[model samples]
Target: MTNPSTLPDFDHPPGTDLWVFAYGSLMWNPGFPFVEKREGLLRGYHRGFCIYSHQHRGTPERPGAVLGLDRGGACRGMVFRVEAAAVPDVLRYLWQREMAYRVYIPRRLRVRTDQGDVRALTFTADPAHSQYCGRLGLDGTASLIRQGVGQSGRNVDYLSSLIDHLAELGIEDQGLRELAARI
Candidate 1:
């Protein structure tokens, strides 16, 4: 559970090439410039409904379930390669977007793509953070997810979108399926 500010910018030269991993909303809405995209497999981390969304998907009074890259297992997600010219701006956009709640700890992980393995920037859960609700069981998770409605619309919609995107990529998440079914 590290703070993003303490780390370097992927240790790359200013305005250089970089890769970013997207497992949740980012996969559908990166909100940044990128030249290449691929379905990459990230090991040593698993996606879970660990974060409580207070704005994007729900309000403080009724937080929504959101995905977080937790320790152990693996996750199949999308990876984007930002060109050198777009690196700085993309990084800035990413930092602002993903770090709003400071609930995620960004890390550089090796993602296995069809082209090859790439060291991409990934946002993992900060277990020590206040927003970290961890595994709240399937029924409990579905409850929060169903009751949530915020600026981004319904929390159920977000889960549906994620499930759709994952399905399009031929990725199967049993936990996600059970949660989705419960909701």
Candidate 2:
């Protein structure tokens, strides 16, 4: 297996099949075409706001939070199966959208799919970057989730979308649910 620590070359040649793991905005708005999508879980990693939001999901004047993969827990997201011929174009789109945060380091992630686990490319937080928010307590997190009008739209929308998606897959995030109630 290729080392997961190294960054992926987004500019792969044509005919290379690409699998992308979507955890946040990409989950809801992939902004790219894919041949298939499946419910997948990633181990040894979880979703958090390790990256700061300055645009897209947040504004420079009133920034909002976006997702950054952190080194703990398990994350449930969608695994996109892209056609080999479209790998280069699709990857470029993903890189443009995800790299907006600039604090993320793209790496290969091991995702558990229905067919079994597969290695896929995904973005994770770079600890050294200034955008890293780290982990937040429930209350602190709820506050941001409740008021989501800064850069990336409403915080409620982000949480609600994730909750809805999880429900569709019969999965639950107790922490997120509890925080949503408070919101």
Please report the candidate that would top TM-score against the real structure: 1
Candidate 1 structure quality by residue, lDDT tens digits, 1-183: 333346644465565688999998788788988899999999999888888888877899999878899888999999999998987677778877788777888788999999999999999999999888776777888988999888988999988888888888788987788888998
lDDT of 2 by residue, 3-112 (tens): 22234543333466778898876776888889989889999888764454666555666555666788889988888989987776776676667665467778777899
Over 4 Å off, model 2: 1-14, 57-62
Please report, in order, the local distance difference test score of every candidate based on alpha carbons.
0.85, 0.71
TM-score of 2: 0.79
Clash count, one per candidate:
0, 9
